[model samples]
Target: MAFLWDCYDAWQRALAAEFFGREHAGQAVVFHIDDDVAQTIREKHQLPESLAQAVKPHIDLGQRSHAFGTILARAQALESEAQPPRSLPLLAVSVLAASRMSRDAEIQAINYFTPLKRLLYGEGADDNDRKRDALDQSFGQVVELWQQLDRWLRSNKGAFGVSTITPDKFSNRARIGYPLSQALARLADRQKLTQFFSDAEITPGKTYSSAYLLRMLDAWTNHGRKRFSRRFEAALAEREPAFASLIVREAHGWDGKVLDSGGSGHLLRLRLAFNHKRARLFWVAPIATGISGGTLTSGGTEIGFESDLSPYYEGIERLPLTPASIAMPLRVHGRAAAGDPLVAKYSPQEIILFREDPHLGCWVSQDSVEAHEEHLLLVSPEQQAEVRQVLQVATSGFVAVPPPLFAAVLPNGWRLYRNVCFEDPAALSRVSRRHTETAARLRPNPIGRPKLVGGLPVLKELGSHHYLQGGAPDLLLPAAGDGSRRVSVSLGGRTPRTDFRATGYPIPLPQDMLGPGRHEISADDAVLSLTIHERVVDDGLPLGTGTFGSMAEEIDNPAITPLVVLARRNATETAFVNCDGTVWDAITPNVPQWLHRRRVLENAPLYYEIRLEPHDRGWLIERTARHVMAIPGSPTWPKEDAILSAEARTDWAKLILDVTAPPKHVLWPVYVKIARKILNDHSR
Candidate 1:
């Protein structure tokens, strides 16, 4: 509608003023489909730090800023001094922290960290029958909260009381003690009622200690998150929730990547629904329009330097909303079976804004509303691609700031992305997780070729950059296991066979495409020489043979033509021809690691690997030939089909086999039969 575009136009102008500091109302400051959104923009173009901080979150996420030990010590010291507990909230977190209930809990919220049973004994938790059932379970479960509290009380500074029952009852339910029954009653009353001594459960005129009764009340309602913990709270937010949630209308999002800048970002423009009913929710779920912020995962988190191992090293981190994170608009979703009411809806519940009587403030017309819901969201790098794909069809408009919060990118009706960066995030940094990937096989299924000597994994970004004198950065290899140990590597000078850089590959025209300047880098012995050009990426497409673009493994065949040869899948005229054989394993292992030995196959291409070692003027397939040449109980043409296909490929890879070799000469009849059987298969 015209009104929608008009509002968009007005929002663009507002963004121009906020982001670019443009003073004129009519100035053309619209976000063009092409304008870049950067982090920490140029000084003249960015908002002041003061201004940026002014745009705080709409929700009031609570923070617990003290360490557990400090809180515990303070609470204990106060008890030792016999002073009335001054800070109820502090005492609560300390007791909760000391309680076995919180031992395994890592969450920051007072509610979430408290044992499910201990939390149920609090006031607000008992409003429903489901909660009451939880409360009753706490009294009767295998290990009751009252039991733990009783033992803790007996241990604390020699405090003890005559009890009605013992805690350990195995599978049977334990009866409540007089001291604990009074504590439970105080908790059930919300800890506010003054006439607690007159309660039906409490003994007349006998007083209970503050440590016993007050500890159960008020302390559970305060702060979230532990303090002084240096662990990067990947929560994006470091606070816990307190109250109601608001409704959100429409949103705008922007996601960008600058490989050169080593960064990616998300930003949003949200228009919310305002009303008296929604006022309280705003205190916990705050929103501000046109804001985008995130730090580089590399420099931001504690997983430093070599990030190949850290989980958060990737972009678009999915930090789910914990009670310690930004407040959710809906009730905490429980783990329920699919289609259950307890399971949260993927998005939020839908509603309408400005459609009801007395329009609160609808900046855009006819827009429906979603009650500020952040339920289950699936986050992945693929979502970034989808955003860019949809943007390719976007109508011409200034769309600034992708929603940094993924919850804003939902439902597809009101959000748009103008661009997606094609840059590889991996290109931004050099990571060496594959340092152990020493070699590539000569082929997908190789037959006795020396694994090529690729000393180190070649970097993808090495393309398009040349290094002059002192031009290259220090090559930091994987740190040696012993720091004192050192190994030497050399970029050897041109060999006498410089005409071809890599070995085990075929001859000219289409093979060994590095052309003029070629060098083989090797480790140990030779002193280094230097020459640099941009690394090329040629994955041995339709052309080259034996070598895939670069020589990753080292193969030694002084004679190239004889080494690289063509062979047929079958002796038939229509058989597919492929190049094979070049490198011979300089030395094989003591215990041979054979590829395939005996395998039953209903089909002809039984795909077996042959390991041939040199014999007297011939080759003996050392490990696996006997099994393939002859099955244990049957002589089938198909078993021969699998092994010899590989063997024939190996033979053809070496242009022709020397028939004078004893292995072939003595087995002439077998070779001839091999030829006839294969040639007859699907014969034309």
Candidate 2:
């Protein structure tokens, strides 16, 4: 033993120097426990056998580091003693050493057993029948060994002797042993594993109390928690990370709040667990009372920005009437089979209240208590004073309201009791897919009149942030009867865009510039001397004649303007070409006459003249005569000139032609057709 101690002491010194950057000559650098232990020894009379055996091999009681070194050395010696020359005497010695070095012995036992478990539960071994039997036997041996240790400890410790009693223990002598007995039972339950340092025989002096017992109990609790954690990991092996995380989370009882994404409930509560060898499970709570799985119900008060119940909003005190929120308790009353009345309600103690901000609109009592009452207590208070205080608080400050209004405002109020279940992963996957599909169907597409002769539909595209497709190629436009006139189309409701293209025709180049802001179209006709620039005047007032704001349909203020208009000016000799390639000379008086002819060709008949008086409706033109002809199909342009001397006054046929150029701008619909034909025909 002496040799072993020296070896361990030397190894510890070396490790400390190498690991802690400390030299042997440093001032008081080594660890020491005597300052505390010596005082404890003086107060307790004789040193505990545990302390003596644990420290006997060390020369320096002043250094905790040296004492621990002795303990490690003795452990090594015990392991060696277990060899071929092992004897019952050596076993007794080992037992004594272990009782003194309780903490170290526990650690060594775990290390020794782990490898054995791995070998016996060999990986990929095909014999399932044998594996099952081996596991049962191994588990049994562990339990038996654990029991033996418990018994040995109980016999040695003299039971955590101390002088003071704690609040947790106020009972007399017969009940003095209750806590110890209860701890022992818990340790032996197999379902639970605990580390305790107490014995039935140990007792403090006659005046000793429960405070000391409480301190020991706290130590044992923490020790058990750590011990169980390691054992659990060893038993489960590689399958432990996720399950361990889950256990720690559950042990701490953390919770999360979920808001509406469109389902039956607006709020959700979740609790999850995973044991790799077992199945993963979760608990869910919807917000609907009597909803089999809801965590809240309609009887509760409403919660929101205006509610005075929650302190969530920054300027909540500024609102006129603050909103209130609640989670009302559910009560069920019915007749039983035995003709007895059945009345029950979920107890407040059984529920968990989770609200970060409690003052305004954040949370409310689901019970039939006052609105201002705090519903934080989950279980009923056993102390009569506490119960009375709760009742008094509920009655004076908070008051309950009608049930229907409660339901209407808080539709997702329900309690998620223990039995609530989670969604199946497979089913949830399908639901998500369906949600995406529905949103797609509601998406808008832009379709228009065929631009080019054989144009195909362009796949409508939208931007990442766009809510709807802007240009659908499938939408049809009002026809230009006989395919001779121009047509116009509008996309005002479902989709919106100021930029557009004719599936195949070219007018507005994909990269061509449009003016700043949100105006759609403008156009001009030189011969007609008409130029219209579509303008929108949108002022922030509620009376703007544009997309969003309006006090009335017809806004007459400075902010309102006509949506579409045609601008024209009488210009000098601007010419237009006939279908037959004719040119004509025109001056001021001829302006009306020339317009008359052009309008006929374009299928736009003028109902009135520019003169202030009502204008004549019917007046077609004779291009050959260079004069007005009031008929639909006048004698085919008199192809040959009349006798020069006889009909010279009206015999003016100089191929009466007008030049035509592609319009700089026209209505999108009208221009798109001309554009399509132009792009398609080689001789345009």
Among these predictions, the greatest lDDT belongs to 2
- Count of residue pairs whose backbone atoms collide, per candidate: 21, 62
Off by over 4 Å in 2: 1-124, 135-398, 411-684
Structural similarity to truth (TM-score) of each candidate:
0.18, 0.19
- Residue-wise lDDT of candidate 2 within 15-99, one digit each (tens)? 2232123122211111111222223432444323332232234323234223223333344445321121111111222222222
Error of 2 at 546 (Å): 50
Q: What is the lDDT of residue 565 in candidate 1?
A: 22
Tens digits of per-residue lDDT, candidate 1, 1-684, equal 334223223332334343224232222111111112212222444433211122111111122222123323333454422222222222222222222222223423332223423432343544444443432333232123234333443443322222222321111223322111121111112111211211112332333333222221111111111121111122112210100000000001111111110011111111222222322111111111112222222223321111111111222222232312222233222211122212111112222122222222312111221111111112133343433332233212324334443333233332323222212212211111221111110001111111221122222112221232222322222111111223343434333222222112221221132232333443222222222322332322111112423333566633222222222122111111121212232222221111112111123331222322221122222222111121111111223444345646443222222222123243334444454554555266
Candidate number with greatest TM-score: 2
Worst 10 residues of 2 by lDDT: 459-468
* CA-lDDT, candidates in order: 0.24, 0.24
